[model samples]
Target: MSWTERQRALLGAMGLRVWGETAPEHALATSDAGLEDAAAPASPSDPDPAPPRPAAPERRRAPAPQADAASPPPRASPAIDLGAVAAMEWPALREAVAACRACDLCQTRTQTVFGVGHARAHWMVVGEAPGEQEDRQGEPFVGAAGQLLDRMLAALQLSRADDGDAASRVYIANTLKCRPPRNRNPSAEELHACEPFLVRQIELLRPRIILAMGRFAVQALLRSDEPVGKLRGRVHRYQGVPLVVTYHPAYLLRNLPDKARAWEDLCLAAGVAEAAAEAAG
Candidate 1:
C-alpha cells in the first residue's frame, strides 16, 4: 500500500528488490558521488566530496548586418545577339555546312540538308538528322515523314511559306546537318559538330517557338536524357525560345497510338507560336 512497499513488491516480482537503508526519496536524490562511493564502499577517511568540474565557456555569434535598400543591383552578363545571325546569307552558310568535316558523319552523308522553310517563320522544328530522302533532296522533313509533318502544320494553320515568300511558314533543321549512315541516330560527336550551325540558325531565325521532334532532337536541344514521354506535354526553353518536344512524325506513323499525344503536342506548340506572333504584331 505504501509507495516503497509497492515498488519493492513490483521489483520482487521480477526477481529483484530495493536495497540500502536510505529513505526512498533520499536514495533517489543522492548525488552520483554517493553512488560511486557506495559502489566502491570507500573508507570514511576518504575525501567526502569529489572535485567540481569547470564550466564550459559560452559561444558567441557575430551580429547580422542591417538591410540596405540602396544597394546596387547585381551585374548581368552581356546580352546575346540573336537577330544579327539572320543577316548571314544561306549560300555562304550552306557552303560552310557542306564543307564541314567536324565529325565522321560527314564522311558518309550524300549531302547536307541545311534546313528548309520560311527564313523568318515564327516556328522552327528541329529534328534528329537528315534521312535518305532528306540527304538526297538537300532538305529536312521531305520524305514520307515530312509529308505527315506538312499535314500536321496544315492542321495548325501554319504554312511552310511566308505570305510573300514561297518557302514554308516553318523552318526545319536537324541536330546533325548530315545523315548518319543507315539512318542511325547521330552520335554525340556528330551532334556536337553540328550544334553551332543549329545555334546560329536559331539566332538568325529567332523563331518564337521550337518544336523538337523525337528524343534525339530533344536531348540535343535541351541537353537532357529524360524520355520523350516525360519531355512532351510541357514547354521547355531552348536559347530563350519556348520548346515543345513530341514524337517525330516518323515515330507517330510507326506507333499509331502515339498520334493523339503528338496531336496534343502540336496544339501546344501552335498556341506558343500564335502568342509569339501576336506579340510581334
Candidate 2:
C-alpha cells in the first residue's frame, strides 16, 4: 500500500520499514549481517527492550531440534477433528478440552481453561496460552495480567462477562488450551495439535472482530511470524473476521509504554467492527 508522508512517519515511530522501500546500502548490509548472526530475528521496533523476567516455577520442556534443509519432511501428526469439535456445543467442547491428550501439555496441565465470556459475543480475545495461574484457576486471563486485560477491555467498553451490552461482550480463548511447560513458547507441533480447538472456538463464536494478543496468537491467526509492532496498524482477516494484533497484556505489563500502541490497535479494531456492524444492518 502506498503510504502518505505522515503514515510513513508513523511507521517509523513504530519501528517498521515500509515494504518495497529502499534503505541505505550500509544499513541494509549491517541488518542482513546481524540477522545472519542472530539465532532468532530480534524485534526490529522495540525502542526500549524490557528486562528479562524469570517465569514462575514450573516444569521445563526440552527444546525441539531445528530441521535441516536436507532432512526428509516429517510425517503429518494426527489431525484434530475440527468437524466434531465444531459440532459439539459449549459444554461438550469444554469436556473435550479437559479430557484432551492430543499434545504433551495436556499431560502436565491441572485442567483445561475452556475460555470465558459469552459464547456469542461480538469481540473475541485470543491470547497465547494458559499460564500457571490460569491452569490452576481454569480461566483464560487471571491474576495481574488478567486484571490489566479487563481494564484494557473496559477501555473499549467490552467485558469478558455477558453483563454488558451484547455487542460489547467478548469471548476470550487461547491458541493452546493448556499452558506450555514453564511458559516457554509453544512449539509448532503443539500449536498444530491444539489449533483445531481454537479454530472451532472462533467458528462457534463468530465474533465480529478478533483481537489477537501476543506473538503466538497473532502467528496462529495470521500464519505469519511478524512482530506485533509491525502487525498492529493493519487490519487482517482470520476466517473472514477482522483481526487486530497487539502486545500481550503480560508483555504490556513489562513494556508499559506499548499500552498506547495497544490502545491504537483496539481503536482500529473497534472501527472495523463498527463498519461491519453498519454494513450488516
> How do all models score by TM-score?
0.66, 0.72
Question: Candidate 1 overall Cα lDDT vs. reference?
Answer: 0.66
Task: Go through the candidates in order and give the clash count of each.
Answer: 7, 0
Off by over 4 Å in 1: 1-88, 162-168
Candidate 2, 1-281: lDDT as tens digits: 25467646654664544433532232222122222211223366856432232222232332343478787633432444555776887788888787676677866788888899987899999999999999999999999999888866665567899566768899999999998889899997788778878888888889998999999997777766668887776566677677778889999889867876776677667666766677779
Sequence-dependent TM-score of model 2: 0.72
Candidate 1, pairs of clashing residues: 159-169, 160-167, 160-168, 160-169, 161-167, 161-168, 161-169
lDDT of 1 by residue, 134-162 (tens): 98989888878998788667655566764
Residue 191 lDDT, candidate 1, scale 0-100: 69
Which ranges in model 2 have alpha carbons more than 4 Å from their true place?
A: 1-79
RMSD of each: 32.0, 14.4
Range of the 10 consecutive residues with the lowest summed lDDT in candidate 2: 29-38
CA-lDDT, candidates in order: 0.66, 0.73
Q: State the lDDT at 55 in candidate 2.
A: 29
